[model samples]
Target: MIRLLLVDDQELFLQGLAMILESQEGLEVVGTALDGEQAIARTRELQPDVVLMDIRMPVLDGVSATAAIRRESPEPPPHVIVLTTIRHDEAVVDALRAGASGFLLKDARPEFLVQSIRAVVEGQQVIAPAETFDLLRAFAPVRPAPDASILAELTERERELFALAARGLSNADIARQLWVAETTVKTHMRAILTKLGVASRVQLIALAYEHRLIEV
Candidate 1:
């Protein structure tokens, strides 16, 4: 089962999410917190598989809480999906920099929310398309050129794959674009991850921007 903990200041929204997710098989709502501090406490106590953390809260904010949670080594920090009303807000960037696995807008559909949770828990990252462009542009001016030395390690095919990845293409999308099977794309993705030393595509995009591998 995919155990989940919700941290939101809005009771109605929290209850609504719990209600929507409870009926789904293999998905469980293990706990709820009205603020970031409680969320951290519940995390230490419940040890959930995923956390839906609100970016703004009373006692502490999600960014600081995510940083705190990540600092606890060997305890296995839950993958966090920061919930925000604004798309690509500076707070969202701060949360990601602090090690959040993903971000979801509060207005996102229930299905999308579920998908975000599943993706993050399974070691994938998801950011809204608009948010991605915003993030890329944040580092555009001062970003260094793509490290050709590091990229030279890539095979020709891997080079193409890396470029598609930097453009935020999904494995399936890259497969279609490259006329390869999805499983083949997965293999290339693993290679890309190893070559880039990135945990997820969000980080990959950030690195690509930082290295000027992709244009703004």
Candidate 2:
């Protein structure tokens, strides 16, 4: 089963979402938290595989809570998918910077939410709402770049794949653009992630911007 911990300050919405998710096969709502502080505590106690986190909450906000969970959890920390109303792009970017696996709109369809959770657990990346690439222009934390040297460890094909992925293309999209198998794209992606020392494609995209590899 895919264990989940839902965190939101809104009690009613939280309960409703849990009911919807629990009805789906393969997902179990292991616990719920009303604020970020409780989220951190429940995460340690319940050990859920994924955290559906609310970006804004009392006591502590989701972004700060995400960073704390990543820092404090033992190896292989639970993946975090932050919930957002999305009026503030900066907060979403901050959540990604804090190690959230992705962000999902608070009103996202139930099917999409389930897909995102499965994708993260299976070692895939999730960026949502289709235009998220342009939205995440938050300053990249890095020095001036050759772009080439920062990505020196990558092969030419990997570099190409990296650029495509950094632009928010899904693996299937990248494969179609390159005329390769989707599995081939996934293989290169794994190599790129390993060589770059990043955990997810969201982090890969962050690094690309930080190093000025992709022109803003």
What TM-score would you give candidate 1 relative to the actual structure? 0.82
Candidate 1: lDDT over CA atoms?
0.79
The top-ranked prediction according to lDDT is 2
lDDT accuracy of residue 52 in candidate 1: 89
Q: What is each predicted model's overall lDDT from 0 to 1?
A: 0.79, 0.86
Model 2 Cα shift for residue 10 (angstroms): 1.3
Candidate 1 clashes between residue pairs 3 or more apart in a chain or in different chains: none
For residues 1-216, could you state the per-residue lDDT of candidate 1 as single tens digits? 999999999999999999999988889999999988898888888888888899999999999888887667244568888888977477776777677877888888888888887877765667854577685575333345456566767789998988888787878888998899988988887787678665567766666766777776
Return the TM-score for each candidate structure. Answer: 0.82, 0.86
